[model samples]
Target: MRDAEYCFWHSPAHKEEAAEARRLGGQRRRRERVVNAVYELEGMTNVGSVQRLIEIAVQDTLGLENSVARNRVLGTLAQAALRVFEATEFESRLTALESVHERRGKGKR
Candidate 1:
């Protein structure tokens, strides 16, 4: 998943999440992993904070772009995305968030 998509999935609050979750289209565990990541991040920060802590949390907790540590990765991304709102624009962030799910999906170019 792209960095932008990662940001999106983490920040979105409304149907965007539902849509992305639907887009991901997989086992309940995968959906839970993604949503779970976003959920965990919402606590420390809401959105648009973007700071060193956020960066560290994302790369360390979420493993940057690697989902090998799936739960940890999502947790990290969710945290960073919530904070990144301050650093980046709205759509760019959304794209970043969804990118993760997009990559995980079965087919894409």
Candidate 2:
């Protein structure tokens, strides 16, 4: 799943904000690799690949040791992680997503 974003900018201020998202989201293709590596090494069964990676990342990377708190943090990170791998395989799935968004945006001209 490629998490991609397309923003509509009607003003210069919005354009600047969009630029920031674009810049930060650049090279987000690494999410799949990092998450995949974590799951493979940890052998986490219950968590999906994305969630497993997020759990390890919160613990190992963020140094959250408390299990309960770690889970909460991991949940937040899981949401963020969705953005981390944007458009890695974007071109393939993008057309469908774009089509849906396009149809919605252009309804009943």
Candidate 3:
């Protein structure tokens, strides 16, 4: 067995350890999937996703016992929420402008 080319973890002497490692790895992956499903934070393609993330951060930070760290995190979340609001406002305005332009173009034809 000493002359075998198998790696330490793959060797027959460490078969149980290898099996346990594989089992733990699979368990971790399943847990992550469940957490991701619960949070739905995989693909943040829209403002709603960003808002949800900020909301979650704010909620979690509120429970912190350290005031300084809590306030810092809350401040950051506030700024992120403000930025998202601004972007939503801008998007609404741009959409309205595009609608007007489309209507004017139709009238010209």
For 1-109, candidate 3 gives per-residue lDDT tens digits of 5788898688988899899999999999999889768987764788998888888888888878878878888988899899999999999999999999999999999
Give the clash count for each candidate.
15, 0, 0
lDDT of 2 by residue, 13-70 (tens): 4688878777767656466568557567444453355555665676684675568776
Instruction: List residue ranges in candidate 2 displaced over 4 A.
Output: 1-10, 27-29, 41-109
What's the CA error at residue 28 for candidate 3, in Å? 6.5
The Cα local distance difference test for each model comes to 0.60, 0.63, 0.88
Error of 2 at 39 (Å): 3.4
In angstroms, the error of model 3 at 3 is: 27
**TM-score of each model, paired residue for residue:** 0.21, 0.27, 0.69
Residue-by-residue lDDT tens digits, candidate 1, 10-36: 655445876767666766767667854
Collision pairs in model 2: none
Q: Report clash pairs, candidate 3.
A: none
Better of 2 and 3 by TM-score: 3
The number of residue pairs in model 1 that clash at the backbone is 15
lDDT-best of 1 and 2: 2
